[model samples]
Target: MTIAEVSKKYGLSADTLRYYERVGLIPEVKRNKSGIRDYTEEDCRWIEFIKCMRSAGLPIETLIEYVRLVQQGDETIDARKELLIEQRKQLIEKMEDMKKTIERLDYKIEIYDQAVVKKENGLKRTYD
Candidate 1:
């Protein structure tokens, strides 16, 4: 597929795709005779993997290291697993932090809701 097709398919900008390729986030995309990018299935897979990793808040440097290890072949399998494990741990920590923030927001909202209800009850009594 062309870069445009890939961009549309993946919901990423063409420039982002090109940037990913340039930064080694994904492997080099194959070029057609006209020197335009002709992404193969394997290329698309890499794009998907990189996009998913980025969505999970993985750092670009971490992804680049993972890709570099992937290019180095199967000898890096254990290293890749360890990298993924560490990233997963970080993601879980971030998730916990977000959960705490959400709980705090809920608590604040509940307080406001109770104040509003109390004011409404007072108004009702005054009108009655």
Candidate 2:
């Protein structure tokens, strides 16, 4: 598929796709004779992986390193696994922190709700 098609399909801007190639986040895409990018299935797979990692808050440098390791053939398998494990640990920590924050907010909201209910009840008693 052309770059435009890939961009539309992946919900990424054309410029972002080009930037990913330039930054080595993805392997160089093949171009047709007319100089248009022709993305392959493998390229789409890389895009999906990169998008997922980015959404998970993985650092760009870490992703670049992972891509480099992938290009280095089979010798980097253990290294890649270690990298992924470390990233997963960090993501889990972040999730835990976010969970705590959500719980705190919920508690605050519940307190306000109870206060409102109490005030309404007091007002009704005063009126009656």
Candidate 3:
């Protein structure tokens, strides 16, 4: 299929696909006789994985490095696995940070509610 078809399949814009290719985040695409990009099933799968990893907050440079490692073939298998594992650890840390943020917000909200209640009581006392 072409770039358009691949973009439609993955819900990504054609420009984004081109940018990914240009940035070396994605491998070079195969071109057909018309010089249009010809995307294959493997390309689609790779794009999907990229989208997932990106959504999970993986950096573009990391993805690019991972792709480079992958291109190195079997020799870099362990390195690739380690990279993924490290990324997973970072994701967990981000999740914990988010959890802490939420907890802090909750605590602040509780204090705000107490202030509101106190204000209401003070108003009642003033009226009395």
Per-residue error (Å), model 1, residue 89: 0.4
lDDT of 1 by residue, 37-78 (tens): 999999999999999999989999999999999999999999
Ordering by lDDT? 1, 2, 3
lDDT of 2 at 57: 93
Residues 70-103 of candidate 3: C-alpha lDDT, one tens digit per residue = 8889999999999999999999999999999999
Better of 2 and 3 by TM-score: 2
Most TM-score-accurate candidate: 1
lDDT of 2 by residue, 48-94 (tens): 99999999999989999999999999999999999999999999999
By TM-score, highest first, what's the ranking? 1, 2, 3
Whichever of 1 and 3 has more lDDT, that candidate is 1
Give candidate 1's TM-score: 0.93
Candidate 3 local distance difference test against the native: 0.89
- Candidate with the larger TM-score of 1 and 3: 1
